[model samples]
Target: MDEIIRQRIRNSKTLLGPFPNFFYEKTPDYPQALFLEWFQVAVESSVHEPHSMTISTIDQHGSPDSRVLILKDIDNEGWYFASSSQSAKGKQIEINSKVALNFYWSEIGRQVRIRGNAVTMNKERSSKDFLERGKIAKAIALLEKQSLILQDPHELEEALTKQLIKLNRNPKLISPSWTLYKVEATEVEFWQADKERKHIRLQYNLRGEKWVKNLLWP
Candidate 1:
């Protein structure tokens, strides 16, 4: 590992700080509302790719995999994103509905962690979402074989060309197995940046089918 990583690890082993910024936490009963406020702020600010989040999943062999994916939708129910059912993350969700999602806006030094159960939306809904995408996205979707092996780059390019030609002929055709899945959070954590080292952390938990809030250490 790098020397900087080693140094950071050593620093983490100790508690040292001037500690002060838990004061920005929002008022009672609306943790999600606070998240919305921060998200809106991020959108209006200069932070690039604010919608990108780390999607954590476990493979069939139990190894955890995490990669950044753009957020597609958000509502009171949860966050949504679409993928091919054959993709590794998609397959993992099918095998185990439980997963974690993390959003970190480093420019603003804010982060959100969500633990939830994923539910695949209906086929029609998935198709509608796919159809609504831009032409380049649609073309790329038709080309990339998510999580599948590609032996030859030229072969893959040829396949993409063929698919594009087909797409040009009839743009209405939707991938038979495309899917949109939503991660319905049972727990959510909101963390805000600190001027001093303290930072602000708030967590919401689903207890007996109801959401309960609690403060947490930074």
Candidate 2:
């Protein structure tokens, strides 16, 4: 790499800047309640793609891979997201059920981290989720045979064309292989960026059957 690019990468660690003015002992224990509040704040702050979050999963070899996915639903059950059953992330989840989801709202200077075990939703639910996605998204999902090697660009283009034709014929058609999954969090942490010194950190963990919440020093 060039020296300038290397320097920029090295110096990026210092950009976290001291902390900020706000500090909270904890972000309130209840996961649903606190997350709802944070979500509302993110929405009101005009954060673009607030529902978009990073999902990190580990393969059988224990190597980590991550990709951004939009949150499909959230409630007392768990955080929901969906993908094609054949996608790398979905396959990795099968091998290693452990996963982490992260959210960073740059405009509001806030972040949330969730560590959990994911389980696939039923086919009926998965189909509903897939059908709810926009037509173009459904078309794209149908086009990709993820994690497989491609020998020819024209082959993919041809596949995409055929998929689009099929999709156009029936807009309500859902990808048969698409899967929806929910990550049942074992632990969750909420971090609010601080501009000066101290910051807010709250961690909620599942102990036995009960949820225990704690505040961590930042």
Candidate 3:
């Protein structure tokens, strides 16, 4: 069985792409600009869930944990994402503000990695983001028992029904635990894969108010 599994894994192919060329020299002064460009191309290429990314946070035990989440927004303030303050990732962020975000568009053989410190946005912004969510999403967030054990499935349904009714009575209801966080990136790396095994990696590092770009060997 072990030999069979190993053979299966070793036979698998990767980095297969009519991949786009990365002319790192022609990249923008800021990493955000290049990120937006690459993101747009991924969208145009019909990549699935192009806005989805893996967010990694350190747990209380000093271990790494990661999960996939949707990208909310991005700007000079950095990448935006929202979650319940009571959630595992949120609690982890509070303990250690440092985090890492990774965006991989496998179809295009491209990836972007960001290392940064996350900070909570203003209350108004967080509230606005929560209100924009669909009713079901808002109801689930109101429960605020994320990453908790579920003893019974019926309990969830009952709780959700109650929350939905509460929303109907007060459409403006918002969860205080729902928070929007922005990651202020210290370094952003862009990687583009080549069919011939050569890969291009461009990294932008923030130093004193200016961004310094460098090439990394693949």
Candidate 4:
């Protein structure tokens, strides 16, 4: 079974469609602006979950850890994602603030990688975000102890029932540990894959308060 899975994966291909006419001429001029533009294009193309991204963080032992997370927001402030302060990712960020984000839209043959520093959002803003979340999401945040070993699966189920009651009583209740983290990008790379494998790689580095752009070899 393992060999079958490996063979299928190894034989699969990418970038098989007729090359889009503008792809060859397109160059990343402004990193953030290009990102927003590409994101909208992905949406128009019906790419599923365009705002989902993989975030990588360094654990205390210097090992790398990563998980897929929904992108909450983006602007001149880099990117935003939410987590609990006691979550595995949150603890890792506390030990080391440096992190990376990866966005891939296979339907568009595009990817964006960002390396940056992460900082917790202010309490008021974090609270607002929590309040905006659905009741079930709020109940999960109230759990606070994520990624923990469970002796029984029903433990969380029972806890969630109690939390739902609490939320029903006070919809405004907010968990102190639920936090929003923002990444301030120091380097951003935009990649576009070509059928011929001569991929485009454009990188932007933040220096002082400005961004310097450079083209990278395929």
The whole-model lDDT of each prediction reads: 0.79, 0.83, 0.95, 0.87
Model 1: per-residue Cα lDDT over 1-218, one tens digit each = 69999999877732232222334544545456666777887786666888889989888888888888878888777889888887888888888888899987766777899998989999998999989987666776777578788898898778877888888899997876678889888888888766665667788998876778888886
Model 2 alpha-carbon drift over 4 Å, by segment: 1-27
> What are the per-model numbers of colliding residue pairs?
0, 7, 0, 0
Better of 2 and 4 by TM-score: 4
lDDT of 3 by residue, 1-218 (tens): 99999999999989878887788889999999999999999999899999999999999999999999999999977999999889999999999999999999998999999999999998899999999999999999999898889999999999999999999999999999999999999999999998987899999999999999999999
Which of 3 and 4 is ahead in lDDT?
3
Models ranked on TM-score: 3, 4, 2, 1
Error of 3 at 170 (Å): 1.2
Pairs of residues clashing in candidate 4: none
On TM-score, the candidate that comes out on top is 3
Estimate the TM-score for candidate 4: 0.94
Model 2 clash pairs?
A: 19-194, 19-195, 19-196, 19-197, 20-194, 20-195, 20-196
Give one digit per residue, the lDDT tens place, for model 2 in 1-218. 69999999878743164323334544555676677888887887788999999999998889899999999899887999999878899889988999999998877778899999998999899989888887767887887587778899898878877888998897877777799999999898888776653567788899977779877898
Which portions of model 1 miss their true places by more than 4 Å? 1-25, 28-30
